[model samples]
Target: MMPLNNSMLITGGAGFIGSYLINQLIVKGVNVICLDNFDEFYPRKSKENNIKSFIASPLFTLIEGDIRNKELLDDIFKKQTIGIVIHLAAKAGVRPSIINPQEYFDVNVNGTLNLLEVMKNHSVQNFIFASSSSIYGNNLKIPYSELDNVDFPISPYACSKKSGELLTHTYHTLYNMNVINLRFFTVYGPGQRPDLAIHKFVNNIYKNIPIEVYGDGSTSRDYTYIDDTVTGILAAIHYLEINTNVYETINLGNNYPVKLSDLIEIIEEITQKKFIEKKLPIQMGDVNITFADITKAKQLLNYHPKVSLKEGVINFKKWYEKKLV
Candidate 1:
């Protein structure tokens, strides 16, 4: 990989995927500016600890702010000379989005617009938007494709993501900015967020708490490990180095869907502990399944995921034991 000439700004840089990506950049000695508000979606301490590994590095600059703050974004753009922007900040979670639709839109949709405007002003065209598979919603499609109709988002979070993707498209159309909307599958692994199933299940199982199962354990997710997802993102970032003035949306996933029940069993096998299953009703915004079709990612970005669910679960379990337990 060629050396980066200017700093890279990663929105929500302290969060799961962001933190991991930052560590990778740090190892490469790439100058990085991490912007995160430490949203209360989870404890701020968790996010703080995620960056503890490289926060003190001279290559990294941490900004404590929100993406909605356009003035702050502009100020950073004026100072940092950022060559690329990886927008990952958002009010995540589909179920919570059902209760507070406005917050989701405010942070995810409007906040994204703020960042785009700032980048437009700065003339920093390279952008990689961290989109979600939830945008697929309850589409009858088995393996969701980037070309599939993402117009039917069931939850506010999904809707906000779809809106962000559309807004990115519009910015690309008008400004001729380079944009790649990566529709990430269920990303899991070390430093996984607390609310995610892999994180929660491992914690609850370890503490002998009841592990909740929604939708009769039939609903499945295309779980892409954090390492794999971050690789695709880095590829997308480097892609702008060779490809320019284009708008593209690609799916980055394991291209494998594992049943909810099977996921729990995998966890049990890894931990050598049985879970007290508490079957719950299906979530309102939850989709029946999320299976990614990564053909476009492979063709364009040469994105290929290496981690399997079992291997990813074991890696996460090792992390859980070392960090939380």
Candidate 2:
């Protein structure tokens, strides 16, 4: 396999997964242009700090812009010879989507459309989009697969993601673009969004605050580590390169579901602090479980998640403790 070209664009590169991917790409000697507007969902300083390690790197370029800004996108596309686009920008969160559905649609769906249009205009065909397993919304099946029926997405966020997949398919069909939509399961590790369960729990534990235990603690998630997820993303890039066929969607997850209670115990073990649990009713747009069927990813992209939840939590705790200090 030939080395990836120097020029690449990673939308939302300031966010959790995006920052990690950019760091890995830079280490591989690839020039990366990161586009992010620093949405208010998280602290701008957090996102800013996330990319500080790469700010001085000659291979890294930061563009403070939104994906919704069509003119900015057009300008970047026209100026840069971007070989691959990893679209990870989106208004991420399930319960938040319930309160602001339109906003989620605008960012996740419309913003995605703008990116696709600019890519098509610039002839940048190779693409990898950040899709979510939330698209499987309340799926009865234990482990959801790419072939599973995903027509019934409950939350607005899930609907928007599914729409993005459809839009990507349309672009691939019309322009013969090689697109891969990676339906990521619950991704967690250092730099996780504060809104996410693991991060919030870790923070609360350190602060001696009651950790909100939504639902009955029976809910489970296939928590994929950041490194493992990045590996899958890299594999998807290669997969598209090797098989320049139409569009494809694959699951990037550990395929192991751990109950909420189990996760809390792991966190407790790592932090050595007992969490004051505050039980709350299940919030809207929150699913009971998410178990990814990674068979497709394993076969197509040669993807396999390596990090276990216990190890992942320990790593996250270490990072959190350092950050607090």
Candidate 3:
């Protein structure tokens, strides 16, 4: 069983999911040390605002550093009494990864390696990795399972994540580290990163901007909400407390896929506005669909997602009006 401590290190703790995770941990009175470099994937200010609400908390520490920085991670490990590591830092977005494969590999793969090396040195064995459903690639299987073959990744981002999982597995095999890689589906909600489809569509429609419709708007994704994903992360940590001698991957998703066109319609209905649609060719690396088989999550962690797309879109629009407006 993994050791219990008050402190936990969460990389990329300033991003959308990290912010929510930090907040929840803070409420539970866990000492959370957030490490983020504030990469320009989006504006630094938005990411700063994500954790600004809880930045001043006594139990929270925000470290501005890159995952690629071994010295910085070493310093944090040496100084702080962190019991577990939640690795969430990555160069996100499949389209951007295509344009800059080197940067993606460097940050996603090399950075994860650097962190794992540091963790090995410190003997911090309990770990929770934030993986992506994009690793499933264009598989013919519906409702991709943890047992599915993920050898064929179309984008550098997916490849990077898959590499991270493999690295984690090796560590588990050699060091007996406890690890759980969570394959998060298309996560969307209030304060979501602007690059995601649901947020972009809602914002563009509100501003009367033309929305990009890729693949004739038939592409579908299993959109998991922020709360459900965070709950699963906490459960993984809890599971690690009692279980060890294991390396496992589970899908933390809603298990319900929504089409791009139907998502647009929901946004329009929520905002009471129509958007101009601009059709684009099916992107080369884009997958046909992403449907998660969350059966393992339900059985292992008792994970049950409670949000629907319509309700989630409404919630997103409400937060968008207040924050983005």
Candidate 4:
């Protein structure tokens, strides 16, 4: 086994998934540089708390900056010997993207371009990009696969993610960069983004506020646990190291799809509180269901998600109670 050295950069490192990835890498004795501008989509304090555990570790370095800043990225690329670039930074909400499409494009597409340009100039080849299931749009298919057509994105955020994947493909084809675009499903568990449904529902329940149920509460999502997502990412990293000849895209998600009502009920059961249900029309940019076909990930990356929704929710509720109190 190759030893992890001073050569891993995780963009959006202060955020939920990025923070978890950073910790995992650090535990493996890898020197990791985390870069994030602390976008206003969520409270900065939350992101700060997310990475608080790594603040004192010598192997961890946090660079408070934006990926859009080409000069800053160039300086970092020159200074550090980065072996792998995990691109996870972006303005991340789908509904917000509907109101401001340009902002989404600038941050998601242009920012990714900036990173790729810097990597190209520095001759850093390895990359793992964070793509989304939103790119699948409203496909009639039950479980989305990597081979599924992703041309029709319903929201600006989805379009931006799709654009990022395309740009990654371009870089891999032209610059010979070894890349893996992981299309993450609805990831939950501890350290989830406050804007996400699970977090919002938990917070609302704690505050004794109404939990909004949208679209007759039938919308379903492949609620993947954070641990499983991290496992998939680590597998991808190992897979890329061994198979450096090609670039690939894979879906990382729980095969099970949980409905909105069922999820809420589980939360209520965990909290032992009755939620004041506020039913509303499904918001735009929201999909009816998201189910990932992880066969490709299993075959290529040996990815297998272990945590079920019930187990994940119980774990999250315990954390939420502690944090809230």
Q: Number of clashing pairs, model 2?
A: 0
Better of 3 and 4 by TM-score: 3
Worst 10 residues of 2 by lDDT: 1-10
Top TM-score model = 3
Compared with the true structure, the alpha-carbon lDDT of candidate 4 equals: 0.91
Please give me the total number of clashing residue pairs in predicted model 4.
0
Best prediction by lDDT: 1
lDDT per residue as tens, model 1, 61-142: 9999999999999999998888889999999999999999999999999999999999999898888899999999998977
TM-score of 1: 0.98
The parts of candidate 3 lying over 4 Å away from their true place are: none
Q: Please report, in order, the local distance difference test score of every candidate based on alpha carbons.
A: 0.92, 0.91, 0.91, 0.91
Candidate 3 structure quality by residue, lDDT tens digits, 102-138: 9999999999999889999998888889899999999
Per-residue lDDT tens digits for candidate 2, residues 64-151, read 9999999999999878888889999999998899899999999999999999999999888888999999999999987998999999
Clashing residue pairs in candidate 2 (N, C-alpha, C atoms within 3 angstroms) = none
> Which segments of model 2 are wrong by more than 4 Å?
1-3
The global Cα lDDT (0 to 1) of model 1 is: 0.92
Model 4 TM-score, 2 decimals: 0.98
lDDT per residue for candidate 4 within 1-325, as digits (tens), equals 2224548989999999999988998899889999999999999999999999998999988999999999999999999998889999989988999999999999999999999999999988888999999999998888998898998889999999999999999999999999999999989889799889998998898898898788998999999999999999999888877776568999999988899989988988888988888988999999899999999999998888999888998898888889977
**What's each prediction's TM-score?**
0.98, 0.97, 0.98, 0.98
